[model samples]
Target chain A: MTIKELANQLNMSTTTVSRVLTGQEKKYRISEKTAQRVKDLAKAHQFAPNQIARNLRLQKTNTIGLIIPDISNPFFANLARTIEVALRKRDKMVLLCDTKDETTIEEESITLLLGRKVDGLLVAPVGEKWAHLEKTNNIPMVLIDRYFEHKEIPYITTDNYAGSYDATSFLISQGHHRIACIQGLVHTSANKNRIKGFQKALADHKVDTAQTFILGNDYSVENGYESAKSLLQAAEVPTAIFALNNQIAIGVMKAINEAGLHIPENISLLSFDEQPYFELLSPPLSSIKQPMEEIGIAAVETLFELLENKKVTSSRLKPTLIPRASVKSIVKS
Target chain B: MTIKELANQLNMSTTTVSRVLTGQEKKYRISEKTAQRVKDLAKAHQFAPNQIARNLRLQKTNTIGLIIPDISNPFFANLARTIEVALRKRDKMVLLCDTKDETTIEEESITLLLGRKVDGLLVAPVGEKWAHLEKTNNIPMVLIDRYFEHKEIPYITTDNYAGSYDATSFLISQGHHRIACIQGLVHTSANKNRIKGFQKALADHKVDTAQTFILGNDYSVENGYESAKSLLQAAEVPTAIFALNNQIAIGVMKAINEAGLHIPENISLLSFDEQPYFELLSPPLSSIKQPMEEIGIAAVETLFELLENKKVTSSRLKPTLIPRASVKSIVKS
Candidate 1:
C-alpha cells in the first residue's frame, strides 16, 4: 500500500500522513489522536514509504559505487571484500562494477553509476586514460590499486617502487646479479613504478645491466609461462626471476615445471603479490606482500572524507618482504 | 543543468524541452527548428535527463542485486564474475552485497536491495531459513549454489550427491577401506546432500561404517586443519580423506605437512572444488569440479525468465571428477 491510500483511509491529507510517518509529527504539530489513527491504519495495511520514492525526496540513496578491473584476481577480490566490510560499517552499500580491465567498459560503468546518483565512488581504474573518470559529475571518487599520473583523484595503493626495489635488493644480496622481472600492463602506474624500482635497485647494486632483463606485457599466467619458456631456452638464463603479480608467478611456475626445473634449485623466484596458498606450493614462494586490507580500509576512509567535502590526498602503504623457500641464497657463508 | 534552467535559457516550456530531449518531439508536434534549437542548447550545456529521475518515471532501474555469502571464496568469486559478465551482455548492472555468511547480514542486504527497487535478485543464501527470502517484494529472484528445500524459489546448483558419491566411490575403488570426510556447514543443503552421498557410497561398497568418519563444522581452512590434526592423532587413521571445498583442502594439506607426511605416500586426498592452483601443488590434487560457469549463467538465465513471467524450476548440474596425483591407488595394478 502507498502513502496516498493510507492517508485517504485515515481521512488525512497526504502531507500530514507523510509528516507523521517520517517522524515529523511534533514538527508539524499534528494532534496525538490524529497521528495515532494514521499510524494504526498504516500498520494494518502494512504500508511503508517506497524506498525509491523516499530516496528521491531526500536526494540521497546512501549507496557508493565501486569499480574494479577484475574480480577473479584474488588481490582485487580481497580488496573488494575488505572495502565492502568497511563500507557496511559506515552504513553504506556498494554498487559494484567490474570493468574486466577494459577502458570502454570502465567508461560505461562510470556512466551507469553516475546515472544511479550514487553518493560517492571507489574505482580501480583500467587503461592509461583518465578522461572518463574526470567527468564524475562532481561525485566524490577515490581510486584504489591503480591511478593515473597527475590526476587529482585521491588513491590508496601499495608503494610499488619501494616494494620492487627491496625485492630486487634481496635478490642481489643473495649474489644473483642476473634477474629477470616479468611485469604486467606496461601502461599502469603500478607496473611503471615497479619496473623503475627494479632498474634502480640493479643500478645501485652495480649489477651488470646486460645480464638483467624485463619481459611480459600483461598480468596473466599465460604471459609468465611464455616469458619463462623463452628465457629458459636462452644459453645464459637469469639466476633469478621476479614476477610482477601472483598470476604471473603461477605461469612462471608452470613453465618451470614443464621445463623440468625446480624452484630455488634450477633458479630462484620472487613474486610481487602474496597469495594464501603460496605456502602450500612445493616450495613456498617468497613474496613482496602488499598491505591489501590496509589499502582497502584507507580507500574507504579517504572516500568518506571526500564525501564530507574534506581535502584528501593519495596514500601509499608499504609492502613487506616475506622470505620463504622460493628464493635461495647463493652467497658463501 | 536542471531541465527547468535549460528551458528558461531557451525561452521554451519544460514540457517542450523534455519532449525534444526524450525523442518525443514529433509526437508532441514540436517544430523541427525548435527541436533542433533545443538540442543544440542542451548539447552546449551538456544536459541530460537525471538518470535517477528517469528511472523513477519508467519504473525500471535495469539493475540486479547479487547477494553472496562470501566473496573471498574463489568458488563464489568465480560465480559472481561469470554472472556479472553474463548480465553485462544484457545491458544490466549488478549491485553486489556480501553477507559474510551471516543470516542477519543477509536479511539486511535483502531489505537494502528491495529499497533500491532492483529489477531482480540472485542470491547464494546464508543460513537455512528462507522466511525473509519468501518475500521479495514481487521482484524476480533466483538462488545459486545453496537453496532451501520445498521452497518455490528457483535455484541452480551442482549435483552435490552425485559429486560426493563419485568422489567417495573413487576412494573405495582405490582399495581404501577407511576414509574420512571433512564436511562444511551441517545445515546447508549442499553440505547435507554431500554427507548423504558420502554415506550412500560407503553403504553401497559395504565398507565398515565404524572405520569412516565425518568431521568439520564450516567450509574453512581452520576446520580442515583441526579435523585432520585430530584424525591423524587417532590410533586408527583413515587411508584416504575427502575435503568438502578448496579452502578445506588447503587446510588438510597444511595438517598433513605439519604431521610430516606426504600426499598419497601416507594418506590420499580428494577435494570438492577445483582451483587453478590445484594443478600447481606438489602432488596435484584430485577434485570434484563443478560446472561453476554454467551454474552462474543458468542462474542469470532463470532470473531473466522469471522477470518475463515464465515458470522456472530448480536445476542441478553434474560435477566432474578430476583425477590427479593426490589420490593414491592402494590396490595392486
Candidate 2:
C-alpha cells in the first residue's frame, strides 16, 4: 500500500508515518506511542513501507554503484565479493556493472549509475580520461584496482611498481640475463608502473633491452599465449618470463607445455596476481599476490568517508611475492 | 534538483515533468507541446529527475535484487556478469547480495531487497525453506540454479540429473568400475539430483557401489582436496572420480599432486562446470559444461515476464561434455 493511504487512515502527516515506518522515528523525534500505533497500522495493512518514498525526502538511496572491468577474472570477482560483504554490514548495497574492459561501456556505466541515483560509486575504471567521471558532481566516489594518471580521484590499488621491480630483480639475481615480461594493456596505470619497475631493475643490472622484451597489448589468456609463443620462437629465447597477471600466466604455462618445454627447466616463469589453482598447477607458480581483500576493505571505508562528506586519500597496498616452483635459479646460464 | 521544484517552476504537474524527462511522454499520453516544454525547463534547471521520488508515485523502482550463494565461484560470477549485462539493456540495475551459502544471510538479503523496493528478484537460493520467500508477495521474483520442491516459484537451471548421469556413465565406459563422486552440499536440490544421477548411472552399468562411493558435503576447493585425499588413502581407491563442480575438481587435482600421483595415470577425473583454465591445467581437465549463459539469459527473461505479470514455467537446459585429457581409458584393466 502507498504511504499516502496509510497516512490518511492514521490521521497523520505522510512524513510522520514514513519516519515511523522506516524505523527513523528517533532521528525525527517521533513519539514512541505514535510510532507503535503507526507500526501496528502498517502491520495490519501489510504495508511494505516504500523505501522509495523515504529516499525522496532524505536524498539518499542507501545504495552504491560498483563498476569493474571483468567479473570473470578471479581477482576482480574476489574483490567484488569482499566489497559486497563489507558494504552489506553498513546497510549499503552495490549495483555492479562490468565494462568488459571497454571504454564506451565504462562511460555508459557511469551515466547509468548516476541515473539510478546510487548514493556513491566504487569503480575500477577502463578509460584513461578522468574528465568523464567528474560529471558525477556531488556524488561520492572512489576508484579501485585501476585509475587514470594524474587523476585526483581517490583510489585503492596494489603497489605494482615495487612488486614488479622486486620480481624483475629476483629474476636477474637468478642469473637470467634475458627475461621477457608479458604485460597488460599498454595505457593502464598499473601496466605503466609495472613497466617502469621492470625497466628500473634492468637499468640497475646494466642489462640492455631488446625490442621483444615487453610483449603485450592486453592482459587476456590469449595475449599471454601469443606473447609466450613469439618469445619461444625467437632466435635467442629468453631464459625466463614474467607475466603481469594470473590469466596471462596460465596461458603462458599452456604454451610452454604445448611447445614440449617444462617450467623452471628450459625457462623459468613468474606472474602477478594470486590464482586459486596456483599450488595445484603442475610445477606450482611463483607469483605476486595482490591484496584484494585489503583493497576491497579500503575501498568501502573510503567510500563511507566520502558519503559522510569526509575527504579520502588514494591508497596503495603492497603485493607479496609468493615464491613457489615456477621460477628457478639459473646458476650456469 | 527535485522534480517537484522543477515542476513548480515550469507550471507543470510533477507527473508531466517526470514523464517527459524519463522519455515516457508518449506512454503517459502527455501533449507533445507540454512534453517539449517540460524537457526544456528540466534541462535549463539541471533537473536530473530523481528516480527514487518518482518511484513512490509509479510503484516501480527500476531496480532488481540478485541473491546468490557465492560470487567467487566462476559459474556464479559468470551468471552475475551475464545478468548484469542483460538487466542494463532493459534500464534495470541489480543489487547483488552474496549469502555466503548461509540461510540466515539469505533471509536477511531477501528482507533488505524488499526494503529497497526492488522491482523484481533473481535468486540462487541456499536454504530448503520456502516460507521465507513467500514474504515477497507482490514483488516479482524468479529462482536460478536452485529451488524448493513444493514452491510454485518459477526457476531456471542446468539439467543436473542428466548431465551427472552422462558424466558418470562416461567414467564407467572407460573401464573404471571403482568410481568416486565428489558432490556439493548434500541438501541442495542440485546436489540431490546429481547424487541420484550418479547412482543411477552406476546401477545401470551394474557396477557395485562401495560405502565410499560418494564423498562430499560441500563444493569448496578445500573440501574437494580433503575428499580426494581420503579417497586416495582408502584401501580400495577408486580408479576414476566425478567432481560435482570445477572448484571441487581443482581441489581434487591439488590433493592428487600432494600425493605424488598424476591425473589419468593413477586416477582419472571429470568435473561439472566449465572452468576458464581447464586447458591450462597439466592434464587438461574434461568437464560437463553447464549452459550458464543460456540459463542467465533465461532467468532474465523469466524475471522480465514476471515483471510484466506474465506467467512463466520452469526451464532446465542440457549440459555439454567437453573432453580433454584428464580422463584416461583403462582398456587393459
Q: DockQ: which candidate is best?
A: 1
How much is the lDDT of residue B280 in candidate 1? 83
Candidate 1, superposed: residue stretches over 4 Å from native: A26-48, B24-34
Clashing pairs in 1: none
Instruction: Report residue A211 deviation for candidate 2 (angstroms).
Output: 6.0
Docking class of 1: medium
Instruction: Give model 1's clash tally.
Output: 0
Model 1 — interface RMS deviation? 1.4
lDDT of 2 by residue, A18-135 (tens): 7897679999999999999899988897777567767776777888899988887888999999999999999888898888888888888887778768899999887566666888
lDDT of each: 0.90, 0.87
Docking quality (DockQ) of candidate 1:
0.68
lDDT of 2 by residue, B120-146 (tens): 999998856667788886688889998
TM-score of each: 0.95, 0.92
Residue pairs with backbone overlap in model 2:
none
